[model samples]
Target: MTQDKHSRRRMLAMVGGALAMPSVLRAQATDPTVVGGTAEARRNISSFRTQRWEDHFDSLGVATLLADTQSRALHYWSADGSDYRLYPTSVPMSEELTKRGYTKVVRKRVGPDWTPTQNMLARDPSLKYMPPGPDNPLGTHALYLDWPAYLIHGTHDTRKIGRRSSSGCIGLYNEKIAELYELAPVGTQVRLI
Candidate 1:
């Protein structure tokens, strides 16, 4: 019985030591490269605004502007606002423009045109549509803003267009977003009110 207890104790001690080894090794791991890389990237992005739009205007011309209604903030970026780090609503237009490498061209107040049927479809994603186009819910074209899940686009529900009717999507005249789509590049800056 004593031998059996001793064997069990040894087994338990071995298991305990094995479990403790991982915690000790994890605590000792302090790689400067991993830590410094994140810090350097943040610093580089923060200093990005100082580079000036004039310095890189040729390459940094407006690529995309995002407007967020939830936060009531506008974010501009190159290649559909995809290249730069995200910013808060408090950042100034000039700073946002410089950071994203674009110049602010215009700020506008756009309204939505929503109807009962459209609301039903948006709320129920299961409803099938041919695809997003001129007649689609997405409208003729989509002008994405910084607002989460909101977009400015043409609507098939013309009657509801131009009124405060959308759940959040901006309802534009079918020809408007389409025409704007052609005039505005993939990265054009948008100012939202």
Candidate 2:
């Protein structure tokens, strides 16, 4: 009967759609969502580019952070002659930090505590003190540079890495910065060009 065939077709379609819905839900759950205030989505896969082929240090034996404002990425060099596979990281940028020149690491701290600057608090009093943790702005490690206004540090939100959303200091993915923190000692020179 025509009526019976139409009912059977509608039931089959509903069953098929219902079976497919869970897969779509699972994919959305697995994918990471946006965090903090990032303009771009986070990328997991990265290919390293040759920033410098020769050891420009000439075996001076000091790790360095070569931060490029234009690229919004930081390149790390090991004084020990070990080459690291490249990972493109998102770096924070602002109008004032376009030219930082060269600065040295003044201090280093792990699980660094974060307190909003008086200047920051003045502007946004609603911002509260954030304790150190996975949610902390400073993330796992922080390397203070000679410039008090800025430093090289890790971020809790991996999404913010490639975005120009930080107050001023450059931020790296948590694992990347942690690796650098262990390798780079205080007084390591950081050049921004």
> Model 1: per-residue lDDT, tens digit, 21-133?
86665454222233644621122212222122222334445554443333323334564334543332223123222222223433222233223345457667676545544
- Global lDDT of each model? 0.45, 0.70
Q: Write the residue-wise lDDT of candidate 2 on 1-193 in tens digits.
A: 9999999999999999999987665444223355776433333323222355243333324776777654567877676648443334555446764446778788999998888887678768988888889778888999998887577888878888667767777788889888888888887777765
Q: Which ten contiguous residues of candidate 2 have the minimum total lDDT?
A: 40-49
Best by TM-score: 2
For residue 20, model 2's alpha carbon misses the true position, in angstroms, by: 33
Cα shift from native, residue 158, model 2 (Å): 1.4
Off by over 4 Å in 2: 1-50, 53-61, 84-87, 97-99
Clashes of 2: 2
How does residue 3 of candidate 1 score in lDDT?
100
